[model samples]
Target: MQQNAPFELLSQLRSEAIALAAQGLTYSTQSAGTKNIAYVVNGVNFYCEATDVKEVSVCENLMIVPQTKAWMRGLVNSKGVLYSVTDLSLFAGYGRAIQAKKGHLLLLAEEAVQSSILVNRVIGFRYFNESDEMSSLDDKQEALDGLSAFVDKGYRADGQDWYRLNVSKLLASEQFREVQ
Candidate 1:
């Protein structure tokens, strides 16, 4: 009877392990698919990888810096950490953001950059499959003229085109690095 008891417990444990493995496989496959959270800046749709954004906050109490470019809005202190805020609309040649005080700030995930960009609003997430990707933006080139260097890809979803912003490339660019 004791020997049978041990064998039964082992069988139960093996089944549990098998069930857990199957669940893990399903979760991994679901997360591996492409999804993007789109945000709007001056009426244009833009998105970056989920890992590229650290946090989002409302624009408030920004300390203006001296002698910086127009696009460089100012510095903001968030939770004891200082972040340089760039006005995406102004930087992308879309003119000044009308609702500067009522805008949203996207804190970048870069450790060394410690910067964020101000946008008009956040439009929420939208999952895009491979079929939605556009190889070229030839027809809409003028629309993204200022951001062409940082935009690597585009997607069509919900009757609008979403541009993928490469945060790493934008942070490393000379134009972005030089605030003056």
Candidate 2:
């Protein structure tokens, strides 16, 4: 056993070095350029800056608020923080989201917003090069109709167009602020 001690230490150091290198590679890939968190709302694909989302969790334990807008799902207490929840499908005029057994809650990163949006499903992080961006999405009028005000850019990847939703602008818009 004593004779193998040095070899064991070397093997452990090699493993640790490999692990650290992999972590650094992932960080470089994610931080070197922008990545988007893709999600589906009413069967439409949408993207938001990964940095804009602070957390993603299952939609559960929602406490309905009284006399609010129809699209306002209610309040959700997550990690001891109260967030106003909105049904993205309904809010975007795409109709109500299908009552799935489990939906995703995208918690915004902004401290002042204190809001989360419910989506049909989350498609995970997607990376798009600058060449993938499209200046105009004229063919996707139906999907952009209600979300146009919040979406200023679009990208195509994996044979689909992903509309980027500016969560900051959406949260700051007068229409969203008028939630009575």
Find the candidate with the highest TM-score and give its number. 1
Q: What C-alpha lDDT does candidate 1 achieve relative to the native structure?
A: 0.84
Q: Write the per-residue lDDT of candidate 2 for residues 1-180, one digit (tens) a residue.
A: 699999999898778778888888322332356878999987788989999999998888889888988888888899899999888887889866645247899999999989998998999988887777887877787877678889888888778888999999999998887778
**1-180: candidate 1 lDDT, tens digit per residue:** 686999999898778778888888432332356666578887788998878888888988999999999999899989999999998888888876536688899988898999998988877665676778898887877778688889998989668899998989999999998899
Q: Give the residue spans of candidate 1 off by over 4 A.
A: 1-32
Give the number of colliding residue pairs in candidate 1. Answer: 0
The Cα local distance difference test for each model comes to: 0.84, 0.85
